[model samples]
Target: MCWFSGLIALSMLVGMSSPSSAQSTAEPAKGRWTSLFNGKNLDGWVMKLKGSDLGENYKDTFRVEDGVIRVSYDKYEKFNGEFGHLFFHQPFSKYKLRIEYRFVGEQCPGGPGWAYRNSGVMIHSQKPETMSKDQEFPVSIEVQFLGGAERGTRPTGNVCTPGTHIVMDGKLITQHCNDSKSPTLRGDQWVTIEVEAHGNGTIKHFVNGELVIQYEKPQLDPDDRDAAKLLKANNGEKALSGGYIALQAETAPVEFRKIEIMPLDD
Candidate 1:
């Protein structure tokens, strides 16, 4: 996915919400880390699956088990490309987000080859309710997660744009995904991925406390069908500053824990 050479820069910062029809949020004290996942239940999250409404956890794809949010596909007899997302729902602006995730088990039958051991955390995303019923992915900046396979390099902590674009050196990155400098972490090992996001100012990715990819100015790509609608809705504005946080479930199974964040002052 190493197709982009330049990063992006923007200055628009806005927070949005629409969580299970209740736009509730918590005011985390600045400099204090607040847990996003309680390790008990899906108390503050909302589910969105392809071909389903905004609140359906299709086939129970995302569940809390043994104090971790596990993305599983055991109930499905086969894969149907029904991608899903578990949104924290609350909109956040400047913050340092932390997530420990690990890929496990095998890919679901009939799953796409590209999705093997692949998932992501979607930041600055569109509201779930605004998504089309058949929309495969929301317009967001994806902190792509990938587990190593038997072949060549497969770097995690990468960036993938779904309906968005990023800039660096004053040029828009036209590719869909960009590789990070992190080494391949093979096997089912716990990997800590941290993101320091300054609303729409700048976002940097860290793998195991080491910075791997840094970029700025994340904005909506006007060329994308979904993003174009969003630009129209926002009066043609494309600079994305803030929105919901989402956990992506592509066909592979993964687990997340220690989901926390510390609000950053503007």
Candidate 2:
């Protein structure tokens, strides 16, 4: 090739590889945070409610509106312990999930009093298809979210295990719920929460960047009827290393504005 033509091609190639140009077109790294909720529709999520078939969105309970995922029961006469969940399509073994949510409106009629303004994000959860027709919750580690009460402190970022167990402070925890050291968030104010799940390793919860709760070794409960079936499927494997993510619809109305995750492994 002529010297002038070679020089022109080299310059064009260099321009295409320039930092500014690359930055504009480059995709995020494999471990970078990604949005789970697209803010406009439920394209990659599945809904499951107790006593209902998979993908059954009873009473339009889970919907995307106004650029957020809203868990509402405006069409229901009573909650009736529907206990719904919206599961993400993909499953992950190690990652950090961040979400911004706010409790809004009021609990549905006949909803449990203790579940007022309460919902959760379940990690390392059993698949939605594995749940019993009447299962209230899946076998997983719940990063519980709760709004403050009228007269007392109602801490958020707590941990709840349903049909599962965890070890905290090196001791096996058999309790249903474990409280965190986070301060109460009152009213309909938005709260940013983060959960870091490291497969079968330790998991940590953070409220507005403050680490509040930490636990380890989430495993299936052989005594739980539904979890026992899961155990049998895995040849009695108890340690939950990888599973789908799900958002709870536990009677109260809540709005999740953002749901994002950053994978830690391939």
Candidate 3:
């Protein structure tokens, strides 16, 4: 070929292989991390407390103040096992959820002893409207959070299955709760917790950037009353892939500053 012709062909090849050209033609990745809690108000959230109707914020239990969403009971004279949940409006399939929380003051009087400094975020949860008027907890997977006591070792970032179960290490786990190896954060210290859920496949837990727990195959329990109805609607396919996210108000004062999620699917 002539030198001029060869040079022109090489220039065209270089142009085609340029980064800008490839980027313009490539399919873009989908999804982005977004703030679930507005940090200003509960604009996209609903409330459901045990023994009360849906949307009832018993004694104003859930509120937003100082750029934080708080589960407070200072106005109540007692704690009566009024298990409450503040649920996000949307449901998700595959995502990473992160939140920052801390225990404040003391557990309310009459609160369960086991509930001291205990609160959690429920994922893959049943809809609020489906829960009975007296249901304590919805069918979900709980990323259980427990503040450290002044005395002994109390782990945080544990897993608590309510009306559901998971498989770990290829074994079908039937335990109600599985403790993580994470260190206990005593007192009123801010702690960051994160969960990576891959639909009905695998789920993981991390605290302060350290991986503490991992499991797989989360499914609804047929024996659970609340979950039984869901099981039927799901065509008896126990695999739980998607559901709502809710924050717990289990007779304790807790504050959450950040609640965000990053979608995994396009």
Candidate 4:
């Protein structure tokens, strides 16, 4: 056999999918920080919003402006429960992800009251291609980012599970959202958010380098339709190790300036 063909077989034996430029879902070398966004365009990302196909951007809900990714609603006449996520092409088993974001101008018309200044990043998320049409969110764990008045005490870096559950302090946490210990951050000032996910062993949220919340053992919730489908396909493995990462657009105007990740050892 040819040397190149032998090398390909060896890679497959170790479970590494060859990179495709169309998908751009390539894995980086371990311990190296890589910038996922090129700051020029959305070349390696895919959009999936409500009532739209997997690759559809849905009325240009997400766009790049001034070297940043902006969730726009300028063309929308109304925000009718259209929740969306922009997913990176690949998944990481263990990594530290960091992004800078800020709340932008007015919320879209008819947006949810609770969604104001609310956005999140989904970690360990299901692949966008597998998401069913009309699925509001992927089966993942969310690192919620919030901006509001300091008096309101709305904290960023909170944990919110859409179709998942987690364990903390040796007990299972079944609730949907858990507030972080982050200080209140208001206005349009940019804030840095960081997430440390150790492949289902322990995941942590940090706001501006301060540890906010820590949890472990993120698993699928069988009662949820999306999670159930995932379980049926993955031999019913309840413990989630890793998956894709996605940015959230929950009817709130938000902007992300930078997104970087560093792969870690398992």
Candidate 5:
């Protein structure tokens, strides 16, 4: 069987809950549950990056309309500047974060490449303000979300880490991680992604009831180029780890619904 298929089977065995079910359990539950996105506006969120343009010009790039926090590139004719990241106000060491997202519209101009249509949910990221003035993108583990242009591609809830590294099976798995399986869903379908982050740096990425990737100790790999750059910019490599979380607005348009968080007590 394929790696992704095996991951799906593993997710089933773990009894992971969907976003809807998890949200349902939030009310009057045994533990504390918090809503990351206010749904009406970007209340508890902050945007920061390298350059003077902290975000996508604060336009419709990251905004809330109706009840959803949408990451749209409708205003941009193209993605010019460096990288852009939208982060939550609170910093999390360990927690279960659940988000619903879907890609929309066509690719923007000056996007990355074919992969530019890609966007990500960054976890275990550094402080937004601490980033360099010329920094492009973030040095965090990206819970990559992808859609298929063709039928039967790969499933959603893929994983990709940039300028980050984690431990898996006692081995150091540095930055640059991707799903072996192609996306299976296409068009504008809302897919659910749930992540369980253990404070010690262990994390699991799940999509639509399937576990796509597992990682631990999210920190700069020390071997990656960006990690090296960030190290130089920050004056050290230890500057990473235990920061905040952010969402990507690469060149594609995407929307996030039900962005909620439940802190896990270690």
Candidate 6:
């Protein structure tokens, strides 16, 4: 009888210890993965810049369907109007942003004179409410995603700082330029782009798991009008410490999927 009682107590003790043991031994979840898109609706996204209304009325430019956020030109008869931007609701200072995008369909009329059929992912972006009604686009660092038809057919990850500048290897790369090597996968295939942004103003751009571009301390050029505006809005600072993230709607139809972000702590 004593043996039976001992066994019962031992079983209960072992059962109780099981959860605590698992709690202590279980591995931690890998990297902080967060879904930027809800896959059901644009819950944490906002539309800004030249559509109609103050972003709420530009339904044709940005829309969600079939678990993807698509930037389309179906509603635009011509792309003569101002450019458009779709910004995430939250601001992230340092993190890895991974996005999958593919180009589809033809360019519309008045579409950037043949050089603007492409779209981009704008990082370190300023608030949209701070700009004037006639503002074409935000003054932010643009990770320019180009298609095959762009000027040099450089289907790679490039940089275009509208109201921003960056220091690379002790010199200033103030102008719009492609990366030293093209990191783009050509054709209509979907490409996975990853950007690792360090809070200290350093960033790395990756394409299909390969590092393509790296830079640090992006500031605004003194002579550029957009840079000046950004500086003024942010208390005369040349570079943004951190800001919002946006997807562009140029003149062509583009589709985005698997848009995810993971926050990193220093």
TM-scores for every predicted model: 0.91, 0.88, 0.87, 0.90, 0.77, 0.82
Overall local distance difference test of candidate 1? 0.84
lDDT of 3 by residue, 55-125 (tens): 88899999999999999999899988799999886666688999999999989999988899999999987
lDDT of 2 by residue, 1-266 (tens): 21111222333311112111111112224678888777778877888899898888899999989999999989999778899998886666788999999999989999998998999999887767667789888777899999998889889999998988899989989899999999989989999999998888889999999999999888878898877776665656678776778999999999999888888862
Query: Which 10-residue window of candidate 1 scores lowest in summed lDDT?
Result: 1-10
- Model 4 residue 22 CA deviation (Å) reads 3.4
User: What is each predicted model's overall lDDT from 0 to 1?
Assistant: 0.84, 0.81, 0.82, 0.83, 0.64, 0.67
Where is model 4 more than 4 Å wrong at Cα? 1-27
Encode model 5's per-residue lDDT on 81-120: one tens digit a residue. 6456787755666678888888888877787665544777
Best by lDDT: 1
Model 4, span 1-266: residue lDDT tens: 21112222333221124223254323566787788888878888888898898778888999999999999999899998789999887777789999999998988989888888889999988777767788999889999999985466798999999899999899999999999999998889999999998887899999999999999989889899888876666656677777778999988889999899999987
Error of 2 at 45 (Å): 0.2
TM-score of 5: 0.77
Residue 9 lDDT (model 6): 37
Task: Sort the candidates on TM-score, descending order.
Answer: 1, 4, 2, 3, 6, 5
Give the winner by TM-score: 1 or 5.
1
Those runs of model 5 whose alpha carbons end farther than 4 Å from true positions after fitting are 1-30, 53-59, 180-183, 224-241
Residues 1-266, candidate 1, lDDT per residue (tens digit)?
A: 01011111111222243354342235566898888877878878898899998788899999999999999999999999799999886767689999999999999999999999999999988777778999999999999999999989999999999999998667789799999999999899999999999877789999999999988888888899988877766766777777778999999999998889898986
Clashes of 4: 0
lDDT, model 1, position 87: 89
lDDT of 6 at 174: 68
